[model samples]
Target: MNVVSKIEAAAPAAAVEAPAERMRRVVAVAVEHGDAVDREGRFPAETVEALKRERLLSVAIPAEYGGEGLGTAAVADLIAQLAQACGSSAMIYAMHQIKTSSFVMHGTGSEWHRAYMRRIAAEQLLMASATTEAGIGGNLRNSICAIEVEDGRFRLTKEAIVISYGNYADAILATARRAPDAASSDQIMVVIPNDANRTIDRTVVWDTLGMRGTCSDGFHLEAVGNAAQIFPKPFSEIAAQSMLASSHIYWAATWFGIAADAFNRAQAFVKAAARKQTDGTLPPGALRLAEAAAKLQEMKGHLMAAIHRFDAAQVDAARGDDAALSSIGFAAEINALKVAASEKAGEVVRIALLVNGILGYKNGTPFSVGRHLRDTASAPVMISNDRILSNTATLLLMSRFDTSLGG
Candidate 1:
């Protein structure tokens, strides 16, 4: 069965159609434009439009806000399916969901944020994030910009080094120091609606080796909004409780999708080679195909395990056990998932290319894995696997590893 079919079979019936069914058209649109989007380093406008038309963008929002109220696993699956068709579109969607998760999990307390959630659902708005700054050097936990508040309104000016698809976002979630005198680590997350009060000045072009359609250019961002637009919780708490887990899980799913597609192409090439033989002998690449398939399975198992752990943690967190979400073990495991998935994705793609040999090296053939390789190549550096490992190593120093399977 196909990915959509699996989603349909596993999902319980609801009043609205399953998100998987809706994603079918989106995947088709993405596949149609994936090559051009990559070639021109442009946005996947058609694919995003299909998502809006199907109202899939609001799948992560709560039901109270005119959304479907789907859980994390469901959204991750959809992201993986989209990634198989177009990596850039899938990353764009994944990043949007990460930003949406912050609002769904933390923004409902304030009336202003609640209303914004409603708007996000009702209008199918897309969200971008501005956490990486010029001075911080990819450290989201620290910020040089500060939000200036006066007379119940606030203003912020940030030199963001990378805001993925910022020009096309309807709103942006930005991080900044809580006050002018606050420590760089003391931060807040504010919602900046793309209105007349907001301006994005392009500062750097996004010409990269892979995942070209993301348009992750640098910008000078200035925005004004009511103080109420900010979340009640600190950015640190928000990152621990929602953003961190969601980003890693969903991103791993995207990489998995890219790897899965590459494997599929490799399998096709192997099968074709086998068919050409009259003695019923397997192709020389068959053993390599088997090895790649095993690695792919390992990657999927790791992602699914992380998803279940995250869901269980969310349940505990909802029951007032904040420690469940804040535990060092959980954080370390999620970080490991990102590192493993990123590395394994590149490995699987490389194996697939080896299986297909010269054909996989080409760009326009049915067995081509060139785009898949390019796209997966960006996985490790997205958050920098080295940085994640460094953080995980620090976490491990404070906690003991659990050896039991049940644990």
Candidate 2:
């Protein structure tokens, strides 16, 4: 069976109601400014503003720290909603959430962290993640960037390839290698002020097939003060569990938004064309459009169900690396959903092209489908499907070996 069919056959029960109105506002802002952002390669300032105004940025912050303290499932729902509207905005938004989560989880008690997070909670400040480097890539275990202890303080410098919202963000959450012998993982997560000797090369621009508004540009690092840095946990421990799980969940949720929006658009297109247009006195390509729409709905259900499972695991069980690894199952499920949605994006665009003909490709048509299609298509590659699958296989093999040895 196809991914959609598998999802339909074993759909998990629903858990919570997503903030539909809030999500709709995000979509409206994205769609409204999408073209301008695309035309000028500008950041989606309005969309980001809408999210901040809605206080959606604080979805993950704990209540004790002046945040809503919602769980992963809710945050995922919001991200998926945002993705459906604008992939670039969603990506930017996703990075912001990652930065925010990193701060809250790691920098909670520090005065600098606490002050920064307070501004974030109040929507007065924005944070972006800058972990993915150019030559070194995003390997958490191995990175050339270093933080050396100097005169009882850490001196840090690192290159970051694409820091989303780099231009507008108040802070950046970065990951680098510690003094080699200092830790087992060699990784360290730190927050840096956006203007901390961080010079933007401005050589790279996000001129891809989709998500044109993310403004995820490349940058060069310079010697900067380490006074603003905070380590929530040791690099090895975060790598072994929390960081990976958090990233996967947030990213997976955002892609679902892209899929969901494509599906909704396809559904509306099909319904309208079915009633208004007919080739040879019958609706042409109506059945294909219907199929695509159905698949999208099925995909949404699967995505939500997978999230529910993860939420349950978090709420009712012992939590640790083992518990966090359980999220990989959800990760796989998300991968399948993304695949389904991405493929469906092409199909829906085709259907839209067929149904609306030249109008679909016209200047102001809402059917400007190229953007999300490109963005979603690029997502799997950026995330490294092969790596995730390989890791899953390794984990499975290790579990089986442990079982056989009666451990």
Candidate 3:
């Protein structure tokens, strides 16, 4: 029998708080734990725990599975809002949403996946992805590991160069060569549940300058499961439709949130100084604040325009339609969004630091912009802007010109 045909209700029977209320509480926990998670390079366990308890982790799953069934915009808003409190926490959340898209889009009508989705909604289990391989050099399309099948069961051992919050994840969605002897680019996404019968071997140490709480480091992942554990669809469709666009949207949203924090701080600093003057003279940095605000608006416009374009397809925006998603132009635009968000986030942090003078540089204070500056500085280099530009160059070559939008 197929996994989807097994048995059970479409949605779970469990009850939980509303998503916004749940997120507010989780953000508070993340804010409380943010400092220590960064300073000591530890995981944001408190935030993760709150997320589980509040059942907000399943917000990305379909409501039929007893989840919130939130759309892409709502998910983006949630991620960006959380980022204002903690970058690592938001990054972890963003990854979970990205992984969820895979199952949400492809798992439909599958008996095994339906049950798994029910489990996720009821248990609030977090997911981590091991798509990046050391040999592939950050390319999600290439995999050095291959799955071996025997007796209706399969086993694969993958080297994950960076599995963010790996230690805390309840399941992993991994990519690998389709078969033992398949080409590296012929890949499939496999679901490996972190259950008692399955085992994963990992020893990763992450100590970074910023976004320290993510604890994203190397891991040796090994697991065995029924062949049904593999998604029925190919990874390419998953990538073009959901993975690529969702990743860019969620990630860029979080970066925008980070920049928003810095902008708010800068504006507040200027306002406070302006209030102290008897003559009501505006502070010098007030002009700088306005300039940063303008830049921020532009940044948001670029990101949102791309998001709306994707939304225009009118099919389940997250799952994505083939013809709309396959357009080289759309792909190029998505890549450009990543570049803009990453670079603009860094610039906003710098503006915040400039406005607050020594106070923004100080640590352990509400007025301090040190942490924001540190984390935002790493954004542009996370996926490496150079790589994005190189890939976009090839796509732009064949893209058509629309004179209206800077053709």
Q: Which candidate should be chosen as best, given TM-score against the real structure?
A: 1
lDDT (Cα, tens digit) per residue for candidate 1, span 46-109:
9998887788888989888878899988999999999999999999999999999998889878
Candidates sorted by lDDT, best first: 1, 3, 2
Clashes by residue pair, model 1: none
Error of 3 at 389 (Å): 1.2
Models ranked on TM-score: 1, 3, 2
TM-score of 1: 0.96
Expressed as tens digits, the lDDT of each residue in 300-384 for candidate 3 is 8987887787776427444544677777877888888999888888888898899998888998766788888888877877778
TM-score (all chains, Cα) for each model: 0.96, 0.79, 0.92
| Alpha-carbon shift of residue 337 in model 2 (angstroms) | 6.2
Q: Total clashing residue pairs per candidate? A: 0, 3, 5
**Candidate 3: deviation at residue 213, Å?**
0.6
Q: Give me candidate 2's TM-score against the actual structure.
A: 0.79
Candidate lDDT scores, in order, read 0.92, 0.63, 0.82
